[model samples]
Target: MLRWLTRSLHRKLTFVLVIATMVPVILLGMVSYHTASTITEEKAKLTGVNTLRQVNAIIETMVLDVENMSVFLIGQQEVQSYLTRERSGASEYLRMIGFLTNLAFSKPYISDIRIIPFNGNAELTNTTILQSTLFQQVDTDPQFWKNNTKWWSPPLTTVTSSGIKQTVSLVRPIRDMNTFKTIGMLSIGIDTAVIAQRLRDAAVDGAVMLVQDAQGRTIAASSTSITPSFVKIVTDKMTNSHETERLNSVGEGEDNQVVITAPVPIVPWDAYLAIPHHTFSAQNRYVLQLTAIAVVLAVVIMACAVGYFVRQVTKPLIRLARHLPAVSLERAYRPLPVESEDEIGTLISSYNLLNENIRQLTEQVKQNEAAKIEADLQALQAQIQPHFLYNTLSSVQWMAWMSSNDQIANMVGALGDFLRFSLNRGMQMCTVQQELEHIRNYLYIQSIRYPDRFTVETYFPDELMGNQMLKLLLQPLVENSIIHGLLKTKADQRGLLTIEAETPEPGWIRLRVCDNGVGMTEMELHALRERLAHYRFDDKAALHAPVGQDTSGCSAQMKPLGGYGLYNVQKRLLLHYGERAQLHVDSKQGAGTVITLYLMSNWTESQLNAS
Candidate 1:
């Protein structure tokens, strides 16, 4: 009876359709609601932490400004001279007081500026007059000035001419510049309300912010609504931990709140942002409830409609699946009957067309395999061309010697040597030694062609001789310097070319080709760079595009800005070495030009071959 029930496509589909429609509604809705709640809580906590850090940064800036001001005041000639003077005249005392008053007026949030002498004396300040004995207690305190240190005192109340003010002040000991003795003490008072108001402004509706000292005393708080219990938990966690930043939870379950803590920059203090976890979840609860209700209603409404349509659809597919295996290369398929003009019927027509095209596709695959083999053979032939060129040059050298034309024979011999080194076993890469030799031969032939044209100096370490680089890389650059840059200059001018190599950094090699020649203008260099930007090395069409002049013969006279050799070298350096490789051309008109190539020496030959 079970097999019979399942045998009918409609019966099987009705069971499947009911489970598919109801299971996701029941499972996914619950999972989505839980995931969303978790993410919302995390986002809220993250926002609190970021805001706390921002507030810390602002407070740190203000503290640093006060400290810097103290340093500046101690260096002032008037303050230093007045403090060191054993007995100050009335004119001198008035000058020092005037300077202090100007300083207090210029600074924001400053309640007073006072110079407290270490000796028993009296001095006027920005505020009321103070006797030296009043500050003598602070001067004698070892904790306040240990190792000639500067520090911030905790918030305290002081009576000033303005009113009874609560402030935190930065204290610095004034010392004699020549004797280096503790002369006096300087205090700059900053209003605590300024910091309190900043913290309050940083905290919005969802969070409470606090700025507290190292002793866990609250320096400033955003609101009085913050519970003492929450403050104690944060203080305990901060006092026991050395972390610069951290996030923690307070209380349990629904009563829990997330507390984020960060250090105030350059101050021995911490900044805290405490927010209830439910603050983020409260906004998401109604959404989750609505979603759950909608999911339940959707499942109930779709049950009957899904069962009926799935039964209609599965019967045709059931027939189609049973005959698919029989449709193969060695046999024929029983054609699916088109019983209706719906999507199922259209599917059957498409299947028939696919079956008919299988034979043609097999033949096309065979032809593609043949074409790939032919392309590989052509690539081998191309690799062989370099060897063929080497042999031909050697033959021409001996022929010129047989004719006894000394200059012609020397040129051909040099050209042969250049090609032999360039071939370098058809690997397209060679050691630095072989590369330098190749350039020497090319320059030799050029020297014969243009006598006393340019003097070449090569400086490379003996240790880097074995390092490998692209074959014939430097020859083209040198040729460019001689032909384009040096040739344009006056004959009387010294045409100098210097090829040097060194390790710029670990695992990196740099080569420089510098010439004291008529260098390119800014426009020329910009145009050359634009050409390089558009040239795609991997695209065969772009590489073979009409780059000016063949770089094969070293004597080729390429336009300074339009040389294909420089572009070819640039493209190959980027393609083979990846983006870490760099090529730069620096030139100034009438100054000189320097071409720099940066390459990683850690790469191996097999890696280049693979690329």
Candidate 2:
């Protein structure tokens, strides 16, 4: 086979192409089969767990009703007197039996009620005329009491006038309400048929609902498939197992099933909802079969397409080998058709990429010139203010030293530091700590300028100092908050401004400036956020962006975002960081405003130049 393919390039290439297509399709089918099986089983397990929880809740509600009734009976005056009285005669217990009868008739699920006296008196079922015994089978765990009532018993068989019935009994030690002493014990029998009704709703497709007591005895079940033998198999496999609320498979002869088990809330019993694995996977099987058919069809279609494509690809090579194709810069640079993923195809792709790079580099050159013009204008305007501030602060520092005033001296030193950081015209960006220190110096000056009018809070992480962002963004936002937000508050109210730096997610830094002062109305906020969303890397707008006046040219009614406002910061962000930068503003009238910036971490000078 290798020699026949090597005799000609066409056969070898066709063989290679066919093998590549066939191998991936076969491998993908295998992976899809395994993945689909795993996903189907997981979905089945989740469904089973939810169904069991619903069934357990219903059973808990029934048990709670029984416990509530026992609480009322334990506190009854007549029943408390019968258990604690000095009189031991038969007539004294006669009226106590009447109270038990009235309690049993109230709830329809209650089959019978028993009051077992601890002093060895006959247990009263209905009246003193008949007696019963139940405690000899159960030693009450006092630690499990619901106030005066003890925890319920497992299901038990009882014969009444109607027939033999399964009943789950609730036992309570009657207490004297005043002394809180155990007077006597009472037992309430609940029919298990009501439990079967609750289980019916939990039945999944081809599912059986079987409940077992704490001792792994099947007490209540509601399916025809459940026999004594099957119940034992499920209980044996599931009872000692430590799995909680998850479906596990049980193999029993010809029957294979998956079950989800949940403990009944009030009683120490487990409820099992077993569904056949076959029934759960029936739809999954249909999908797998359909996938097999699709894979076969895909393989057939791939062969036909590859046959015609390779022929066309070979003809192009045969024609090109005779003489090179003519090339000229005047011809439009549209992409040549991709015939096949081969050696020739890679050559074509590289050629296309080179053309794309050339086109992009030319466009980038134009954008760079526009940005340089903008930067020079900004630097010219920026140089004037910082030198003026620095010179004034130097004079104040000398005056404060002569007067021996430490507060005025500290304010002058902060102003000097702020000016020193702000006057870096050679660098367009700075580390996060540099920007934070700049803001702190500015805020300190503002605090000294308006001492009792407002307060400032700042949070900057030390670890984030290594990350870099555009300089002047944070200070401008902080100044806007102080002027438009904080200082505009009512006379009686104090103002607060919070500035924070944190990482909202990995590889992303978030800068937030918040104020608790007069905020923007809805209309103003909407117009501002809409304005920010429309800004892209607009070369013309950024180049001609007026430094001394607001030339944003969008709306006269809206605030001009030329020099320094919330929207101006966003335009700067888009100019340098491209789509990796985002600015969002939220405000409500009379409440406050919050400005948030999301930027990629560790931004570099190359990114600004490219943008």
Q: Looking at model 2, which ten-residue stretch has the lowest summed lDDT?
A: 319-328
Report the number of backbone clashes for model 1. Answer: 0
The superposed Cα distance between candidate 1 and the true structure at residue 285, in angstroms, equals 7.3
Model 1 lDDT, residue 96, Cα:
75
Among all windows of 10 consecutive residues in model 1, the one with the lowest summed lDDT is 551-560
Mind giving the per-residue lDDT tens digits that candidate 2 earns over 333-418? 55555576888777667766766676677667768989999999999888777668778889999899899998899898998998
Model 2: CA > 4 A from native: 1-30, 82-108, 117-136, 139-151, 178-183, 237-247, 252-254, 283-611
Whole-model Cα lDDT of every candidate shown, in order:
0.76, 0.76
For each candidate, what TM-score against the reference? Answer: 0.42, 0.39
Off by more than 4 A, model 1 = 1-27, 87-98, 120-124, 128-148, 239-243, 253-255, 282-611
Tens digits of per-residue lDDT, candidate 1, 1-611, equal 78977787777777777887789778878887888788878777777777887888888777887888788888888777777767788887877778778877876777677777776445547877322222433556765576657766676677766677667777788888898788888888787777777888887566778877777777778876767777886556544354668888776776576788888777778888878776887756777778778887888788878876875777787776666656665564446678878988898888777777875676677789999999999999898787687778778878888998878888988887876776566677788888888889898998888887789999989988898777767988998898888988887776889999999788888999999899979998786666655544445444444445433222343233444377778767766786678788899989889999999774677988776
What lDDT score goes with residue 558 in model 2?
68
